[model samples]
Target: MKRKWKFFIGGLVVVAALGYLGYQGFIASAAYQYELGEYLAQPGIDASQNVQVAGQVATGSIEQKSFDLKFTMTDGVNNMVVVYQGTVPDSFRAGGEVVVAGRRDPASGVFEATQVMPKCASKYVAE
Candidate 1:
């Protein structure tokens, strides 16, 4: 009886280990990070799929409205237009570094940003 119990416990451990490995593999295949240039270069990236794009806001390209905003993002060469319909981040500004999370609109050639994060300015640090 003791031997049977030990074998059962070992089997349970092995099953748990396999389950963990499968979970890790699934997560590894799900998401990834890429800069704006690399993301654009990838062929057949589904425009409807959510993604994060990092780049600097183009200088003199930010247009603000009462409840909407339009801006251009650039990784020095490639540029992507971003449209956001929500409140802008505190660090948002022209020529500032930012990461926009959203899906691309293939027809309009714009990224509809659902979330935006701005890189803090180096020159202005809190004391």
Candidate 2:
């Protein structure tokens, strides 16, 4: 009886330890959300921070070279160039609201986007 209790308690401890580690990992890896203006205004952001910057894609700022996508995101006041290395979504276009997720390139002063999520403005049409 005592041996069975010992085994059960050990299993619970292992499970709890795994759960704690998983939670910590998730928190560390989660993307920090910021507006384009706020992100650029920061004196210096943590280089290791995984960030999601939300803004409107500036007009006439998109340039496509093969699968590479480069565009400027603006908060109607401040702007920053975002360089993404993948095909953008079908909803992606100039003047569209988008959230780019990635870390800033300390060398080039550009946000290196890993993902571009376009928030379509006209998806809902009231019938």
- For model 1, give the 10-residue run with minimal summed lDDT: 25-34
Please give the RMSD to the true structure for each candidate, in Å. Answer: 4.9, 2.5
Per-residue accuracy of model 1 over 87-108 as CA lDDT, tens digit each: 8877798888999888889888
Worst 10 contiguous positions by lDDT, candidate 2: 117-126
Q: Candidate 1: which pairs clash?
A: none
Measured by TM-score, the strongest candidate is 2
TM-score of candidate 1 against the unseen true structure: 0.70
| Model 1 misplacement above 4 A | 1-31, 122-127
Write down the RMSD of candidate 1 (Cα, Å): 4.9
How would you encode candidate 2's per-residue C-alpha lDDT over 46-79 as one tens digit per residue?
8788899999999999999999999999999998
TM-score versus the correct structure, for each prediction:
0.70, 0.82
Model 2 TM-score (2 dp): 0.82
